[model samples]
Target: MNERVLTPRNRGFLFLDSHPAGCRQLVADMWEACPAPAVPPAGDRPVALVIGSSAGYGLAATLAGLKRAGVRGIGVSFEKGPTARRTATAGWYRTAATADIARAAGRDLVLLNGDAFSDAMKDQVADLVERRFGGRLDHLVYSVAAPRRTDPDTGAVHASVLKPIGRTNRTKTLVFDEEGAPEVREVETAPAEGDDVEQTVAVMGGTDWERWIDHLAGRGLLADGFSTAALSYIGSSLTAAIYRQGTIGAAKAHLEATARVLDERLGRTVGGRAVTSVNGAAVTQSSTAIPGIALYTGLLRGVLGDGLVPPVHQLAALWDQLTGAAPLDLDADGRIRLDGFELADDVQAAVAERWENARTATVADLADLDWFRDEVRRLHGFSVPGIDYTAPVATDVPWPGHTL
Candidate 1:
């Protein structure tokens, strides 16, 4: 077998020669690291449909469902491909690896390589549900995080921007690749208009979640006792001026509202329910790209890592809630605030105290704040145990449902 070294900077390598066996082995390793939950044989294996299943929280959720729920089949939708340089998106490698693992475990994993935002993609998903699982999906996860989405009804395309309101807010940030050093800076932002906020809401918010339900219900693909959920986050109040209180916040607000409508609609189907898992801050590609979030996440990670509440732990908790293993509390707006639990009164109070009073606060302090930074690194497929980093890796890889 050809060998290659995979690094944190390079992220992933794509092998030209399909190493089906090797891929299966790697999948087995990942599966062993995180075993699925056991289910009674008499209980029907739940069918899970995961959109944006390529990476980040979506991938974690998919793995959790596979291990914990004994999910027999999984349908994943992601839009990614090999770059001209022959490097696959991290999602592609993950999908390929996951497929091999599922096949070995006697599970059916169907991947759809298409735009989840388009009507055609919706139709394709419905068709897959009809043909593959006899028209019923027990759980649906809406995890797509796109900056822009075209309006299906209006035939208009909208773009999302991250910016602060009025005056430019300067803050300190952490450079993870730079040994966790603190750097002070001013936030550069794009000019925003009322329409910008509305467009962002329409694109990133809950309309697609509702549409997914509407399509599934219309096609009789939603099984009785079904549940659906979308993930959202309110990172930190410091960044909230640009994030939670800005265009993205508007989108999240819309998303939270849409969940209620979906809950009522799905309630009629199978006592089906709609929920939004407000996730904690982590170092995702989406999260990292946000202007002020890196610093915020870094600080939170440091704080949480010091035996404080971590996002992955919160993710595990969210999974428990979804599996009916635990009860969920919601804010007045009817959104399940996983992050709220992470940022509980005491935790937030401590962080606020540090932010207000820490003199000469340095990068070391931030990195050592909590275990969150380490968890964030792990979330991006880094810093995992027992993986040989020196081994040569392939640059050409294929996910099961991708057709070039």
Candidate 2:
């Protein structure tokens, strides 16, 4: 059973069981709030394959592709279904919502659920593109987040760690109870040592990403002029200790390197281009589990204030790049930076200034804690504005593949 903690305001970890009504409302709100860039009359309608497309950035991107670009898509994920033991994962309900909405609008969608890192899953995707999508995909989006991966080459399990590479780092944040009383606390990251870096790389690195591409290319699944992108993150020096300089950061660095390799390889092999999109740091179920990201994002939300960009917005910017609504605006490293505003000199300066003086007492006044808390709960399909928390929400939500 999954661990769950709920708050009086209906904000907290979503335990076992599906909340279908809440998920449906969440999708509706996301769609309404995040309309895509204008799609020209004759512009390219992407036939896309999205790994991890059931939730977070991937889900948003998939929705935009369907609603704005009117594209058919295959969404692959490894989300759990609800059972007697517990509630269904948010991805399952989100997928159901997406497919239901897409089918109503006559948009074709197929949901593939499994270990995306597996070799068989890669083959499944290639065959899927060949059979259902005419052997070619205009776009392949990788937005997967997982802690562990089993090496198909050797059947070895590798788990990624979220610790500093050289030293332990102390991170402070607040926790709320049902009474809304806030308690200040510190979560520390132990130093990553021995095989931690290598294990983290094996679990989170770009080898699987490359393998996915290699398989697709071998099967002639990548369309001519197809574009592929995997998301990455690079915040400020403040997060460098825990993220940009830690185990995950090492993995990200390797991921970015893999993008360059794929850029050249895809161009040469399939007449396609591959690039990494550096996204802004924000709330997600995964990010909340990390040691320092919550505090960092809380401060970030406070500094950025009114215009804190969610992952969906970054995904929208990515969609814009694909549709010619915006240029790639490649950085010196040839990767896209959707965090341009977040990394701006003024924003960073303001945040750094406040961070120095931010204490437990000052965090609420300094950081946008309410937004951070809401976002954290929202990740678990809680604290949604319109959903009735006390109402009966069915646990069973079937895959939306019937819409295909």
Q: Local distance difference test, per candidate?
A: 0.66, 0.77
Give TM per candidate. Answer: 0.83, 0.92
lDDT by residue (tens digit), candidate 2, 231-286? 88888887788888999999998888889999998788767788888888778777
In terms of lDDT, the poorest run of 10 residues in model 1 is 11-20
* Candidate 1 per-residue lDDT over residues 1-404, each given as its tens digit: 23445555421211232222333343445456563344433466778888887666786666666765657555565645555544455566667777766777677777777778888988987887788777788888888788788888888898877755554545544443355434434556654666887888878899888888888888888888788889988766777778887778888889888998888877865787888888876667677667756666655555666444433355556666666766766777777787764577776666665555433345456445334444444443445555555666665566576321
Candidate 1: where is the Cα deviation over 4 Å? 1-42, 165-168, 176-182, 188-191, 306-316, 356-361, 369-384, 401-404
Q: How accurate is candidate 2 locally (lDDT)?
A: 0.77
Q: Itemize residue pairs with steric clashes in candidate 2.
A: 16-86, 16-87, 17-86, 17-87, 17-88
Query: Residue 104 error for model 1, in Å?
Result: 3.1
